[model samples]
Target: MSIDTLARTSRAKRKISARRWLVPYVFLSPAGLLFVVFLAIPIIYAIYLSFRGMHVSGGGPFGVREETWVGFDNYIRTFTDAEFFAGFGRLAIYGVIAVPVTLGLALLFALLLDLPRVRAARFSRIAIFVPYAVPGVIASLLWGFLYLPSTSPLNWILNQLGFADLEVLTGGALFPAVANIAIWSGVGFNMIIIYTSLRGIPNELHEAARIDGASEWQIAWRIKIPLVAPALVLTGLFSLIGTLQLYGEPTTLRPMTNEISQTWVPLMKITRDAFARDDLSLAAASSVVLAIGTLVVSVVLLRMTQKKAFGDGS
Candidate 1:
């Protein structure tokens, strides 16, 4: 080939390569920039704030809160606070009960709805999901009334049946009561996810199982469950994180009962520190710690489940 022709061909190839890479990047730049600005920047700022303290000198509305770096002072204070540790202990209990029960019920409902002969599937699905659509504050208020002795239908029913001293939001019962609310509000959404995953599964897999004389239970256990493992992981991860951040329902229900303290959950404690006490540094530290704990626990749970689901048993 002539030198001029070779040079022209190389330049054309380079131009095509540049455009090939450039188009996807051009398309991706908007989303990438949004994430960096909205998500990444805020997270970085929170971490920065966590390692610093604030000082305010001037009086009245003209006062200034000066942020001063203090290394791990805020984190040290957070770790030493008894109330802070107590929140985690409470959350651990809530998580243990809520995560399994919520996910199990979600899985069960999804399975039942997926069944061929289930009656009123549409109605049942909507009824279950309706609770999830209710605003969190409203759901808490409604459930709060039901938990109250004066307005409780269950209390009235139990009274008619000659029973007493059973309150849903008292002492040890409070944990489960809160868990029930969380479960009710979350189960429908999880069920929908699991159900969608179930529906996406090809029918051929089920037909092959039936030809091998597998019962519905066997098919669900051996085939459907493993195939939908990824969806389950995603649901479980969300549940785990949500359980850790248990705040809104408890906070809303707090006025209804004395059992729920202001710092009932980790998120609540952080909010209290940031707003109620005006300790933004401690709040930031608490937030960073909570973020770390959430990440570590979630990643660990997913890893263990993934290994069991797909790893070589040998």
Candidate 2:
């Protein structure tokens, strides 16, 4: 080719490449900038604050303000504090009860909705999902009232059945009560996600299985479940994270029940540190620890599930 023609072609190719790069950046800039500013910056700041502690002057009397950095002191305090550790233990228990029950119900509802003979699927889906539209605070409030002995429908039903002295929000019942709230608030959205994925499976696959003399149960167990593994993994991860950071339901229900404490969950403890006691450094440290814990748990669970779903050979 002629030099002039080659030069022109090279310049045109460069322009096209530039446009390709520019187009992606233009499309991505808003989300990228928001993530950096809001998510990345706060996470970095929290990590920085986690390693430091503050000081106060003038006997640290009311309204007196002073601050200094004490490296690793705040984290040490968090690790050594009995209340902090207890709160973490409580959250672990809450997660154990909440995550599996919620995800199991979600999966069941999703599968039921996918069934061909299921009636009122649209209404059932909307009814199931309507709870998700309610704010966590409001849902907790509603459930709190429902747990009250004086006004609760469950209490009324028990009374009608000639039973006395029922307390849903007390003792061992508190665990299931809290778990139920979490499940009620979470299941519908997860059900929708799973149902969407279930719907995506081509009907031809099911037909092929049937042609191979597979029963409906076999089709579901061997084909549908395997195909929908990704969606289940996603829902499970989200449920795990939510279980770890449980705050709103317990916090809202605290005023109504003596069973819940101010530091019932890790996030609640962090809030108490930051605002109630004005221990911002300790709060920041706790926040960082919780965030890191969440990341670690999520990574481990994802890896384990991925191996199970896809096989280690992959």
> Against the unseen true structure, what C-alpha lDDT does each candidate score?
0.89, 0.88
What's the count of clashing pairs in each model shown?
A: 0, 0
lDDT accuracy of residue 85 in candidate 1: 89
**Native RMSD of candidate 1 (Å):** 3.6
Can you write out model 1's per-residue Cα lDDT over 241-272, one digit (the tens) per residue?
99888898899889888998888888898999
Assess candidate 1 and give its lDDT: 0.89
Q: Which candidate is the best by TM-score?
A: 2
Please report the TM-score between candidate 2 and the true structure: 0.91
lDDT of 2 by residue, 252-306 (tens): 9898888898888888888999999988889998888888888999988888888
Locate the minimum summed-lDDT window of 10 residues in model 2: 55-64
Give candidate 2's whole-model lDDT: 0.88
